[model samples]
Target chain A: MKKVMSVLLIGLLSACASDTTKPTATAEDRSAAPAAAASAAVTSAVTNPNLNPILTDPKNILSKRSVYFDYDSYVVKNEYRSLVQAHAQYLRDNAGARVMLQGNADERGSREYNLALGQKRADSVRSAMTLSGAKESQIEAVSLGEEKPRATGHDEASWAENRRTDIRYQGE
Target chain B: MLMRSHQSSRHTLTLAFLLWLTSMPLQAALDIEIFGGGATQISIAITPFATEEKLKQSITAIVAADLQRTGLFRLVDSSGPALRDPRQIVYPDWKNRGADALLIGSTVMLPDGRVEIGFHLMDVAKQVQLFDHTITVPADRLRAVAHQIADIIYERLTGDVGVFSSRIAYVMKQGNKYALQVADADGFNAQSIIEYGEPIISPAWSPDGTQIAYVSFENKKPVVYVQTLATRARKAVANFKGSNSAPAWSPDGKKLAVVLSLQGGSQIFLINADGSGLQRLSQSSGIDTEPNFSPDGQSIIFTSDRGGSPQIYRMLVAGVASGTAERLTFEGSYNVSPHHSRDGKSFTFVHRNGARFNVAVQDLATRQVQLLTDSRFDESPSPAPNDRMILYATEVKGRGILAVVSSDGKTRQELSMQAGDIREPAWGPLPRVR
Candidate 1:
């Protein structure tokens, strides 16, 4: 029991350190640093249990509606953890409030492949949400593929913006 | 716990390596944008066919257009003189006018309310008759007869079967209405197979040329439907719980490979012609879609991101458990929408170079990849039945249009519509025996 607590303390300290220095890091470093922070966020949310206030607050991380992903990847970054955690907590708090996760891919591959990749991305978010306390029944995941892109240019900047998952409330 | 961490680290290293490789500038390969045919084009002169004053169609004009559109023949100006009768042909005059071949024909009204068309293909260089034929048909079939004559001349010169008699199907979007249209290879006689407010895409023609399988969004979601050309009747073959798209017909026309999201993600599934025998062919943790059958029907090729980036892979058609899929493309980070050549010797697909996507052909034997088009966004390449030309969709000034490139990458032609975007061109099979 003592060893387990020490290991957890070390992980929490490293995650906090990575979060502070993320802005100056390279893209690769930034991507790797997020996982620790996300796990820490997930752990804290499980302990607090009251997530409705943070989720509905406009200034809180849970209000962030989109989770951006790396090119050709569906893995959720650690930086988006607080946002995903807040939603997961809210779902656990409010049983009737349901949300849908729409996955999207950049316009870079075959349409069918994009659709599949989008679904994978959305499912990844759903997995994260479920792990953070959201019930599987409270979340619906779908893929709009490249058909519904947030940005329409054929450049990297647009593609980065387009590769994301948008969280929406029911009837919104 | 140690094993899991080791595996995760290895996966991250692999992704980092992929990013590094994709960032490297690809070697400058044979990337050429072909605008039109070259000077080696065969020159031929076609004189106006002798017809009654009331005749509504010009057979000679149709023949001239057909031959010219191939980018293989150059039509010498036929306005010099009217040589409707073969007896009045001065071979020396035509030869001096830079004509290697001369075609003269006459159309006569038969007593049985039919039209009799007679034509003779003369080799101007050899000063000898190459072909002579006569056909009697109703007036409505005159255009087809003209195409037949063009095919004969084309075969005599090039020794390859002509595709002038074949047709191409595509999706045309006009205003709020989207239509699945079939048109002559030259973009004439366009007939709408189906029309809807939602989009229609991924048109695939059956090997026998009697049916087309396509994806329609009529049900507020994507669904695969196969429609018989003659009856215009269609039934949804893949209307599962999730999206069903990217339908490809097998060579023998017994099965179709489609992408379904029923179980999760996108996976390749096979279904019978009548929507029976539903079996999953691909099992992947990542996206595995856009399945195409090999010409021999022994293997299937599809796009998958199991390796962290989209690439083309080929596996036996027996089943996924039968054997593992072998990756076929490594030169680029992105390659998809593969269509095997009719001869099974090569395949064409969309390859991305930097920000631009172009059509490329890969030889299975040599594994040589050749870029065929120099477009910013080229997709959905469908090789003609003869494998001599490839039709693909590309963007022109923000509008989608269909373009054809010869297999040699020496000639190109753009087929555009005035009203809306044209996309997802599928070259139909050869005409069936009547």
Candidate 2:
């Protein structure tokens, strides 16, 4: 009778311990699972590892706030592709996050033309992000033209800073 | 100790004298503030009054002081030429002295308690009276008569409406705050309208010149507010989720075009003067902002990047309702901050070429562009009501000053504050009632 009782107590203790350890193991797995799944998704999308460069840090984010053009050019550059891809991956992983992209320009020309140029910059970023798998619902874009500037100085350095799109997280 | 004290006192006195001399205009020393520039100089010769000797000490100096401050004419000194009556300007002698035009005026108090003033603008070269007028005003308005005379001379010479009688509304920054100050066009007699401890920007006067629309960052975010100048009454026009700025009044003063981001992205939104009847004008996957209504009110000229680069676009007011925009400018890589002249003959905007930025005027009918300013930082070129002059803000020696230049880029004048910076000066429309 004593042996049966001891056996029952050991079984109950072991069962409780196993149940507590299971959640800790699953929690660890849950956190690591998304990142692993994300890498796999990226890997599958592009077999070329070089093309699938992981944009891990904000330093790799586009240092330039704006990309200027010669008059009315709207073509995206080969250099900004990796930066755009990183932003796209951030949007895809977060799912429900919405961003407001504001485009701006240096003070020049008519207000209407600057507004159009600013719109093009924002649209370029939006299109690139969309092509990279960012949902359409996650991005809202606007042009400030020559009105709002990141730098107030009317020099080339300031103009370059003024002529780009700013990505802002809208709400939590 | 006494010698050292005397030395220090002398040094202080000398410093003060030098400071006053350097800070004041040359006319201020001559008891007149002549407009500073080289042009067809307009000279005025006032003969010493033979009668009313007691008032001569006061009236003569006051009249001369008033004329000089107009920045329109130079008072012929007692030593520069032979003494003659302003009425009887010897054209040959005046012309030889480099005076292209002349002004002669005198003041007399009538028996009926009124001051009667007579003034004449003589074309020294043509040897003809360009204009002569006699105004009988109350004694209190004697100085105003002097300004009227200055205005007459200014108009006759420049062929453009004189802004000497106009007023200026500016934002005076103090510490981290700003005040809306309304003063004479020469930056005097300024009084604060609203003394809020926040950054106030973009003060624009209504068409009637009674109210001002500006962006005040009172609530941590910039919001458009309209304040009546006469009453100090203010109302918030719009507060969008993001930047709500560049409040431009339509020519008729019935509507305001503003940039509102409440609709997900910043777009041009039209609202009534009293902040009602809000309507969205344009929508793009890109930014659409800085909307200026055409003088005809049939369309709106705004800056957008719908075609992949910031460019000017014109959308008919009715067509914006139908959803269409036509491209306007293609010459430059950058063009922004467009304002139409009162006559609708031309439009002035900031244009960037290579590394330089300047205020350029484009004749709307011909599409011909003329550079109005050569400065790299020339932006916000607001045309005066006469369409003959433009007032723009530019950085001079790292300080911003409001500069006025003839529409043809002939005459240029820089108006700077004693401290701080002056920017975004939208010259108010001519007074409606006055």
Candidate 3:
């Protein structure tokens, strides 16, 4: 229990350091292998509930991976700042970590336009992560456009849910 | 997952693919609904050619359907006076029935297991034969033969080339799978060229009508592929990073203009037929996509947001030309998918007015815009090879279906499938002489 508590404290301190300064995140992430192991531990917690605590706890900010946007708008909302920050901090702590950002849009306008809009959304998320100290090499942004939708409804309720940028870790 | 496991680079309706089709067949027949027509519809009466019923297919019926769908020809009553031959037709009797023109023919099977069809088009009031021809083909080519006869009649009466023999390509999404289909101009004998567990869109037929360039998302990202209709061999024409889509073929069929995002925001790039010689055509930091070449092969029209909203723009694509792209659309803030007519005098595109997106055409000389449809959502407006009608995709009752409109916007029709969203239509060029 003491060791676990020490690890949790270290994780919290590094997440804060990374969110504040890129150089500070690089400095603390000197142990890159162990930090990557920490990400794996967090992910494994999905299947084994007690393996990892903070992100997979179902109440943590890092638990959410989707950044929803307005219709025809790729601007990341104010409500998703901390959620993006948490993921950026996690990436900053793990030097070897890689992520693929899939951007999508609602099926309302021209598909080619939606594709470009979705790409803008992905690029926007990528900018947010890079600004918060995530390495540019560790992230890739791509647009799925309106090709794949989470909900098949033709109403606004479903359209709002589909206009989003999804964050996916490497090997997912 | 199993679908990709069987995914070969080339898929012909060949023997192997035919065997595989047993497990998955072409979805179902498409249903077409036609309404409205030209200002003055031509009244014509067609009688069954002698011994036409003995043959396997109804040649006259197919020809009549082909002509009727154009909204230019109205089928009058050819039922009176037992008119099986041109000599047997009484001009006064036909004139009383309101037929300006009459068509009669005969079909005979040869000893070599082939069929010969001879047709005649006569002016009922003038009492003279305007056209006559005989065409020979194997028994299986009856439908195409009928289309050819209809073309001859259409040309004689309308003073324009007929597109009855032309084909069309579109995408059909059924359940979780999507198919790229090719069918006759009347939506018959649909053949699934490719099927996968992903979305397919923007099917552009080659100018020669032998190949199709489309965007497929089977690789988890959109990649443009050019597939030969005959050999079914395909190659990824544009696989750049980000998204590669909205492929349009040059009129000469030597190059394709595709939208790519490798450098940043979506931009237009030109590539050769075999996917080589990549050249960035449009230099814009904002979104520029959906490139279509002029019929003369000198200029290209595309959709761009460089000037605030999405509007159509034209630029010289030939050698040593102006370095500026002139804006063409000013009325609508959003106008896209510009397809040049066969004559290059006008182009068809989708226009968004308030909440509804409709099909519209703009004359190049007059800069006049003509609204062609009132559908809530209309897309992918492609003009026929004859420059007479426009085929497009529109949503009806929340289901996507194919629709057609005459160049004058006087005639309208819709083609819907039993299941699946049929959309992304590209009117095929006239059948080549091959």
First chain TM-score for all predictions:
0.67, 0.58, 0.67
Question: Which sequence of candidate numbers ranks them by TM-score, best first?
Answer: 3, 1, 2
Please state the error at residue B287 of candidate 2 in Å.
2.5
Candidate 1 lDDT over residue span A85-164, tens digit each = 88888889888766667788897756767777788888889899999999876776666677667797978999999899
Q: Over 4 Å off in model 3, which ranges?
A: A1-63, B1-39, B109-113, B318-324
> How many residue pairs clash per model?
1, 39, 0
lDDT of 2 at B405: 65
Give the docking tier of candidate 2: incorrect
Best by TM-score: 3
Considering only chain B, report the TM-score of each candidate against the true chain B.
Answer: 0.87, 0.78, 0.88
The number of the candidate with the highest DockQ is 3
Question: How much DockQ does model 1 earn?
Answer: 0.08
Considering only the true interface residues, what is the Cα RMSD of candidate 1 after superposition? Answer: 20.0
TM-score of chain A of 1: 0.67
Tens digits of per-residue lDDT, candidate 1, B1-434, equal 00000011111222322232233233112111223455777878877666522455667655765676566776664444456667788878888767899998788898887898888898998888899988999988876777788888989988988877788999888765677889877666677787765567799999999999988654334668888888766777776654678899989998999988666778888899778788888888777888889989998888888887889999898854333799999987899989999899999999998978999999988999999888788889999877888988888888878877778776666766555888889999878752
Residue-level lDDT tens digits of model 3 in B1-434: 00100111221222432232232222112222234553478988887777776777778766876776677876776653324467887789879977899998888899998998888899998999999888899998987898888898999999988998899999988887678899888766677887765688889999998999988776456778888888666777777656778899988899998888766778888889787788888888788888899988888998988898889999988543233699999996889878888899988988998988889999999999999888689988899998888988888677788877777776676765557888889999998772
Backbone steric clashes in candidate 3, count: 0
Candidate 2 lDDT over B9-86, as tens digits, reads 111222322333233332233221233433543565443332323231223343444344333445563223322255
How far off is residue B375 in model 2, in Å?
Answer: 1.1
Superposed Cα deviation of residue B111, candidate 2 (Å):
14
